[model samples]
Target: MPAGYSLHDFSFDLRQHMAPANVWVTSGWTSVVAAPGTVCGVGGCFAPPYAAPDSSLSVTLEVDGRELRDGVRAGIAGFGLGLLTSGGTWRPDRIERSGTFHQYDDGRLVSLGVHSRLTPVHGAGGYVLEITVENRADRDAEISIHPRLSAGQPGRLPLADWGWMAPRAGDLVAAASTSMTLRHDLLHSRVPAGGRTRFTLAVELGEAVEPGEAARPGATEPDPADRARQATDRWARRLATALDAFPRLETDIPGLAAYWHRSIASGLVCLWDNPGFVTTPFVATSGVDGGALCAYVWDTGGYAPHLLTLMLGETATDLLEAMLKADLTKHYAIAPDGTGLGVAYAYSGWSLVTLATAVASQRGLARGLVERLHDAVAALDARFPAVGELRDYGTQHNLLEMRGAGWEHVVASPNAERAAYLDALATLAEASGAVLPVDALRATAHRIRASIADELWDAEAKWFRSRYPDGHTELTYSVQAFDALRAGACTPQMAADLIARVRPGAFLGAYGVSSVSAEDERHYELGDTDWSGGGAYTGEAPQLALTLWERGEAELAWTVLSRLLWMGEHYPYFPQEHYSDRPAAPPVGRRANIIAGLAGAEAILLGLVGVRPRPDGGLVISPPPAPGNVALRGLRFRGRSIDVECTPHGFSVTVDGRRIAPEGGAVVVPAA
Candidate 1:
């Protein structure tokens, strides 16, 4: 295969699929062991979870002494292999991708492909490459291939130490990536016209195999192809069971429906489930960037946990609660080993509380845990406080640090966030049947909400602005306002004024919502592509759409959501941030697999689907109006299976099997 092949070239779907090149298929767990489209080979991996990415072990192919260049197509599931005919018709069925496709030898077609499977969950051992040759002519094809694995630093092994492979008893050599190359495989295939034969090479890593106990790739041991398929099927089943049963999103939009599944797959890749790894269910920020192996509090603060809670239930809670091992009072992200990474970020405190509440209110958490989280927030409140008392949330960088330094802390969103979290926690505490101070927490929340309008409201601009340390209001427009709006910080008039500004050339852009208003030349000029000027934080696009929908801007919400469809159609998953096209600055965004696009699921569930778990152990489901026929099937909520469909008139909701027409789009499914 040519190095020019894109991610779309090797996509093979499992369970469900989309158009080829729309999704990437590889060995289940985020395909961590697989190559980056295999065009460059598997350089980036989540395995060994934190193994730093190095150069890729390159792969190439040839047939009858001539290099194969064209006529390659991806598998049906998107990861399998296929070839093209002279008439340009794609012939597909067998699997794997990358390497060369040699055209013909004396009018006989010869093609090569490999389906690879690496060291499974442990991430420590070797890998296997199934290199196959398909002869598409009347006479049998004779082939001899010797692939030397040469790199900057090839492990200086003695001739006796070289690993071996079979029917011709080949030798495997080590490269820079510790990759073993196939060599001296001179096998005259017994294949006839249109016949295909396999060359299964089993490789053992130098570090994984014992000197005397090493297994050799001798005489095609026990039909390896059949065994590989069975193992892959087992993996697929295990992964399907790892997550909670999610509601399938069916939509008229091209890739929107499949995006829901793709988003979940992205989250699956973030997990580091090696038996001996740090935590059993730990998650890294990116599936590809080996350097990013922590679950960022700021990212969790966004829509990640909301979707996680919805999908994995308390499992998601456990992963997040593990993050609390870090001294949250001073840091914002936590590694698998319990070390906090970033500085004391602005959103850490509430982000923790929000994570707790997402599960506490849904599946139910222990009373002791809920009480501890409440006290933790109280501690944060005492140290940081809200905008009214401290002029900031502990003077730390926030989600939108692009505006300016310390500017994140100066924002007015935390006050509302604090009030909202406290209210939810208070209710959660009561539900757990262990409440120490319900009235006090509610009273405090009430006071904070009142203070937001009294202190931060800019009557002149009819919006809210940050109160600088000097107690002067600075006029600015950014995505932060959307957070304040979600927290119920805006009055009817204030919300109308703030949301109306969400249009093109302002907060809203072609890609998504801008981090700051483009109209603010002075402030915007100071920012770059990392959620600042001329950049769209990829996660925010789906979220802004949800916010707009919830705030009753149905038409506008659809516009934003529709524009964000580019995410699923383009990349395998939503990236951290969408950089500007014009003479852009460096890609200063987080290593992806950030699970930012998870907000798309959140928007659908909470905003458009309008499924909210009430504090009183009931559900307030109000499916919002959507374009075309939209149905959410098999939604497992609070131990209840709920299916919701949007009709021309209101919505059709089903609990278990009986259908109920919500009077005003409000149906109360009692809490489990």
Candidate 2:
């Protein structure tokens, strides 16, 4: 980390790697650094979130001892580029123009400065950097600038953005842009009042190839005024790069904490925001829908806990309180016995159950929150009375009302959804340590498990089946194995068997878990254009595969996860409620369906790391050995710091600087 500069590059290169949320900057010449083979991925250049602007500097580069010629490389993309020009009074003609070859984009001028000069900057190259202005307007503009140069490219000349910043020989720019403070890049020195401010960009050669200093040299001798700005930039880049692995899953079977998170938070957000109205029975109350589920779910359960614990540990208590307040409570319908309407028996209850347990078990919620959750569980519990139960509501899987005399295989049947609810409750109880009505909740869970085993599992099919009023099993691959796994009702072997039947191509699509199995006659094309596929454009959100991975199907889980990620990238972040029956079988993109991105992101977090938070203030850290190199750098968990680097050899973990012995490559850290 440099002293006055707010940015530092991490060894990680996202351009070649696929990550959940990546930021990069690219120009005509500079793009080679992000080219396929040389670097990791294409989107390699990006700015930090906290990138700020500086008005006191400029940048220039010369390649191989020569004043680098122009047009050789792509134009530059700077992170702190627009911050200086953002404010009207910061400096009229905020950008200083210099250089014979400089030219600005035409007609893009603002009253204070030029409108076209407005270029946005994100944390690119781990630096809160900005480009020098190109003085588009006829009049020369005096621009203060800050810039950075790193070692991601080669055979390059001094590249410059003709229309943005003037190429300077050696000037320092600010680290980031903000309202109150501004600091200059260490490399930049004040420029004279002229159009051509120049600064020589330098690079570390062969001898300095390795990191020479253990601690940052800049940290000790920081100027009082500029210290915070630089420090903030350094921290931002480290955190951004450090948390990259968790979001970018290289394999299947999420990290333990990530899995639970996908199940709870990501699950809740998706279910609440599901756009597949009438049939699927979930909708976004109000949020970005075009994303993935696992990420959203994991955010609630896994990432939220893990990151908050690591960085914002003390805020956990308050965050949980806020979460409880934001969540909505709705009544599906009420029976004569006062049991509120329940989701006939599907995946929705899993969200509620997961939340209840997470709140009670992890956060140590008081009696009020616990009791409220318990009451909901009790009412939900009552909705599924033994197996022969009946009610006037005729099976309401919430307010969606499953009204059909024929065997539609609606969720209204108690067996499936009921079991899911029980699974959630058990998880809550187990997580909370003290069960709500200890024996009663456990008893309810046991009964639900038994009912699922007796009524839902079809021996001939050798798998759990969806049910109808006639008691005929639909035998679809939607929620059966998943809910059973969640309820602790299925054996590992049973889960493995279910996985074998539902391969990604058969039952999974690019967007998410598919609704109908590829082998089924009604596969994707079957059913009505609107109210079919159980509201899912294809079928209900695929829960079967999701649960299998959560339970420990790493290899199998990755296969499904890859399909979902493919969908997210192409679909503009549609939450995969179901697959489209269109001849080509595309995904249904909706505003409320961002769960696709969420789930994909979550899979990387949960499956790879296997982070699970116990009822007691403790965490279970498990990493799966998968397809390729997996490295989880700065994973903050429960006041403990875990840095996981996975290579060809095996997994290595360091908790608070202590080498943790791998328990079969998995480690547990007691909570603070």
Cα-based lDDT for every prediction: 0.56, 0.35
- Name the top lDDT candidate: 1
For each candidate in turn, the TM-score is: 0.79, 0.51
Give per-residue CA lDDT, model 1, range 162-184, as digits (tens): 11111011222333545333332
What's the lDDT for residue 257 in model 1?
Answer: 68
What residue runs in model 2 are displaced by over 4 Å at the alpha carbon? 1-349, 359-363, 383-435, 470-473, 491-493, 509-512, 526-546, 567-589, 592-596
C-alpha root-mean-square deviation, candidate 2? 16.2
lDDT of 2 by residue, 51-145 (tens): 11111122333211223221123445222122222211100001111122332333433211111111111111121222232333444443433
Candidate 1: residue 599 Cα off by (Å): 1.2
In model 1, which runs have C-alpha deviations exceeding 4 angstroms? 1-40, 44-46, 49-52, 65-95, 98-127, 148-191, 201-231, 385-391, 394-399, 403-406, 471-473, 525-527, 579-590
The lDDT, on a scale of 0 to 1, for candidate 2 is 0.35
Whose TM-score is greatest here?
A: 1
